[model samples]
Target: MSDTLWWQHGVVYQIYPRSFQDSNGDGIGDLEGIRRRLDHLCWLGVDAVWISPVFPSPMADFGYDIADYRGIDPIFGTIEDFDRLLAEAHARGLKVILDFVPNHTSDRHPWFLESRTSRESPYRDWYIWHDPAPGGGPPNNWLANFGGSGWEFDAPTGQYYFHSFLKVQPDLNWRNPAVCRAMYDALRFWLDRGVDGFRVDVIWLLVKDDRFRDNPPNPAWQPHEASINRLLQVYSADRPETLEVVEEMRAVLDEYEERVLIGEIYLPLERLMAYYGRDMKGAQLPFNFQLIFTAWNAAAIARIVAEYEAALPPGGWPNWVLGNHDQKRIASRVGRGGARLAAMLLLTLRGTPTLYYGDELGLENVAIPPDRAQDPWERNEPGLGLGRDPARTPMPWDAGENAGFTTGRPWLPLNEDRAERNVASLSADPDSLPHLYRHLIALRRGHAALSTGDYVSVATEGEVLAFERRRGGVRLLVALNFAQSPARLALPGDVAGADLLLSTQPGRDTAPVTAEWQLGPEEGVVLALR
Candidate 1:
């Protein structure tokens, strides 16, 4: 085996800045806060930290709608603070990845402000702008990902500007060479500052249909779903031209050494594979969310893993994500017991894995009252249960007031069970979820088989999913029980017997196994084959 790159074998930990920690008593997480809490990540054994957007913004989308690409937001901290955080993180051998929002900018951004001034403005074409349709309505039937028409009418200019998300955030015209140059320059600014990589936001939406055609209506549209789902995003997103744009972005990153580019594309597995580019010149990792979207069952998960592995390009690498700032927490999705099993599956998988903040503590989504809902999508479409505040609540460091997240009132409420489901409380318990994660991470780091081995599916019976990771003589078997009842996993005849290395169950003995292994409900185990 060749020497593995850090991103290929390392685990990535995502930090949602606003909820991670608050060091200034400002009731919000900032750069200084992340700097102070770096030790927690070190202790947890994550290789890299991918922080959400920290650029200057109007807080419209809680930092996603960036107004200034180069400057740090005052709420987060100054440029000096970010430099310090980056320097300290590097010193601790932690790779830092920033969120790059290239699709759109805040409506208040200077580019948008100048673009909206008039039709004749030099910057007018910097964004997607067009004259109103014949009936004085939106140019097409495209709908924003958030809600309503993708086009927002600018009364002064007598034209409608297209936005893939909120009307306040206008999509940049990547077709415009100037816009591409400017965005590329913004990337170089961070690369020059020594950031390791970027998790690009809405990367597939960077380009759109050149003709501005109406997206076809979805045949399976339902009123219960978000308004954007009413129509297929054919014309508004995932255009063929988008791949070329991805290649260009990759070229920018290639200018730097060993810097990674991770695109956030929410397409099906087949479509997602194309983002790897013709010769693996596109994104280094195109954020695989299969684990998050797949049915939480043995058969379903096994099928997805097989299909994804088969679909990878010759030189392409794979990655997995269980939870993120946008989705429901894994504990809430699969109960506490299953979370431990899921953690094992993630760490033992063939490729890279990203662990969301608070997942190690088995943190579930907190219920956010209507008055406390901060997501613009939830505010615009009330009662649809689309709010993300529940998943984005502040981290529970301890059982103190505000769960040790803040001395002031928390921007969002903490998990109701924070008293018991917190780092301080759980870290002391050897059987806690955090300990499970630490052990699994250490195991992956220490063994070449677990970290960079080839994967082979193992035959299994009932609710048990089994696979083998082998690098030459080092062979390890992983068996997981997806059901709530006990299941027996039959080993292959080629494997004479196995020795238990680790088990999700707290007190399970690491004894030798012969023929078949019995697995308790929601239990998962790693075995060393004899």
Candidate 2:
């Protein structure tokens, strides 16, 4: 691994605060809840923790809609609580990365309040605002991710502002230099208070088409109830000018020693790599969601992995994600029984891996009843089932009344099977998924080939998956079976001196220079090259 970059050295854990823990009896999670679980995170062997936004918000979009860039939400806790959480995390030898939402702010934010108060307010031009069309409708036909037109009418100002997401989230005008500087200053404030880095939110949307032209029609639109994916998101996101802002953000991180920034970009592999900026001056690691978004097959995964590796520019780091608050958990996506295999693959990959909270224990999405759903995507339109509430369910720590997440009613219910999957129970079982993750992470850290290695696609056929990770004089071979029946794979090359490092099943002698080996259904193994 490179000596200059700490981000390149290890894994990052992403914690969605609302579901992590609830310290108060109010049923909502707080920083104190997170502070109490530092030891658990440390024990999992993650190098750093990337926390989701805790900024003050109207809760219009859960915590994504920011009302104040610099203050913590009262529901999450005060600034003092954040300081305490940071101090505790550092004491536990864990780095802390805060979520920075710079693309837009809640309509209730003071900047927007003043901007909407008058057409001449200094903050009026800070956001993207334009007069309605001749027909008294939006300026353009761009659609919001949450289902309506991207432009919202403000009666007071008689103008419409761009919002790629929820209407409450008005897009910021990054073309305005003052807005750029202000966002950068907010980032610096967090760094000065001891944050190790940031996970920049929707970074590619910061810049838009200067002409405000209508987006071309999307040929790929397949509506899920009322999703706006039907229309192409041309003018709203992934604009070229966004790269300039990324470079500027990178410069800000460079000002502070050891400060890192990762971007959440949802573009295709080709466009996503641009977030690294020219010559690697953009994000330290732009998130790779291929593992989550693409089909789960050996050939498909192999092709995507190869494509991502080829897309990265020199000096740029790569990161992989399997699940997050926005999507279904990996265990649920694959099969509940395949959770350990998924962990092995994620940890053993050749990049920084981000493990979402509750994923370690095979947590599945909550089946939210229609009446209790809290997500705007679901609440805005009934029966669409677009709400992320199912995936954003509360974490299961113990088999207590509320899964040990809180003393009061949980903001979200724990899975009824929590009795079997809770942390306290899983930690006791030697073969539990959580224990498997711990072992897999330790194995990755022990082998240099697993961390910063060059990945080689090993030729194999049938229900078996195989690959080689090599760096310097080290090489490790990884293989997994996807079928229910035993699958045998022919060794790619002479493996006369390979030694077993880790295997899903026990009491198997895997030596003596055999040209073929058998793997049970969903089985995985790592072979250390001699």
Candidate 3:
């Protein structure tokens, strides 16, 4: 609120474009649909909207396998539609962050198409192509995240090209200066088109092991885990030279003012911090996803907060993510009641918090039947339950057919109970989860201590998570109960004058706490310390 960077203090809401809202009768969400839904984001109090890719694609991996970096897919609309969306979003005082897939391109991409035509093509070096192993197998032991070998043979060139995810999405050669320059120009194209920032996709995988070393097996990987986790990916991702690519992208972003860069990396806290770049020049928000992996226990969460806080490089700002298109929803993972506590933790934490598209309404993972399952990963490996379709269901806008997301059938099914889980229905009930989210967001915005203050973990009893946020003379104590059974926490200080600013439970606020407090099951409260 006081000259702080907007992204450093504001909340980011991610929108999976295809499922957010479908404007036409096409069953897929378009930019116009997103334009119509800006009011919903405004009501939710999000400062910025980070949209997943809507670029032209072959749908091999949904929008992740980008075919044209500069053009919008026909299903999503045209360049003019995007321009209008950007203008409308900014008009509503919301920043728009586009998903930038720099690691790879669709096999249908013109560059990739020409590159595979022959090894002598000028664009051949734009993608990673390698000769097969002596035994005529994959280049090495690298495996595609989606499944199978990462290398796909090209009969014409008599070589194999690398793909980190799907064979349809070929990895780009960041080692080639020309490729890096082309990607930078693509970023410049969007910046010129007035995009506020980019959420760089799989940024850690930008550079790879130059020597083509085989990845070591993951000793802790379980059979139930996705096949990609069988190997640790140490050589395939997070390479030492990845920083070079990060620096180059950061330079491109730096040319624009008041823009942010967020990187989606799945690494431990130690290695994750490196994306902040030397001298704090990497991604503006390198996405602290510890919560996604941390066990849902009070002490465990407290340790995560402490360790993650400690892990922040000097001058690096912290951020948190609870759910995304790739992972299970917080509500489904933690159960219905636990989502309230999650919202409290996500909003009150000492950093920028990214709220996934529909988590506010307690949206859970919907079961996609075999007949309607659309995710490529799930189709590629049907039995592993590795599909993301469950998490990418259409948003529930109202108690109408198709949840009012689309006039016709939705691309993905709505939450089965969309009648009562819709936004309009929840907005009518003051005690609904989305309203609680709004309360927490407003509380964070109005209180500097809650937004950007120093986080001090306070002592708490079993299953109780308590922390104090202090900014100058303002100190706010936030206490939460993670379990279903009620628990009492000893007051850490003279709480005789402390005021309950907000509470997860309805009709429990603006009151004084006694020497000891009884916290309702799955309850969280923010108190103003006098």
Task: Encode model 1's per-residue lDDT on 1-530: one tens digit a residue.
Answer: 25988899999999999999998888999899899889999988999999999999999999999999999999899999999999999999999999999999999999999988888899998999988899889898999888888889888889999998888899999999999999999999999999999999999899999998888889998898899999988888999989999999889999999999999999998999999998999999999999998899988989999999999999899999999999999999999999999999999999999999999999998998888889999988888888888889999999899888888888998999989988899999999999999999999998889989999998656678999999979889999999999998777788789988899999998778989668999999999998
How are the candidates ranked when ordered by TM-score, highest leading?
1, 3, 2
TM-score of structure candidate 2: 0.97
State candidate 1's TM-score: 0.99
Q: What is candidate 3's lDDT per residue for 1-530, written digit by digit as tens?
A: 86689998899999999999898888999999999999999998899999999999988788999998999999999999999999999999999999999999999999998998888999998988999899888889999988888999988789999999988899999999999988999999999999989999999999989999999999999988888889989889999899878977998999999889899998888999999998888898998888987899899999999999988888989899999999999998998889999999999999999999989999999989899999889988879988999999999999988889998888887899999999999999999999999989989899989899989989857899999999988888899999899998666665555778899988885558766778899989888877
CA lDDT, every model vs. true structure: 0.92, 0.85, 0.91
In candidate 3, what residue range of length 10 has the lowest lDDT sum?
489-498
TM-score-superior candidate, 2 or 3? 3
Error of 2 at 360 (Å): 0.5
Candidate ranking (lDDT, best to worst): 1, 3, 2
User: Which residue window of length 10 is worst by lDDT in model 2?
Assistant: 505-514
TM-score of every model versus the real structure? 0.99, 0.97, 0.98
Give the per-residue lDDT digits (tens) of candidate 2, residues 1-530: 45436688688999999989999978888899999999898788888999999999999887889998899999999999999999999988899999998989999999999889889999998999999997889998888878778889998779999998889999999999999989999988998998999999888888888888888877776665456777677877888888989989989989989889899988888888888888888898899999997776667777787888888888778889999988888888988657767887788878899999989998888898777788888877667767788888888898888989999988877787998889999999887888778888888778778887878888656756789999887888898776667888666565555677887764457664356667777888888766
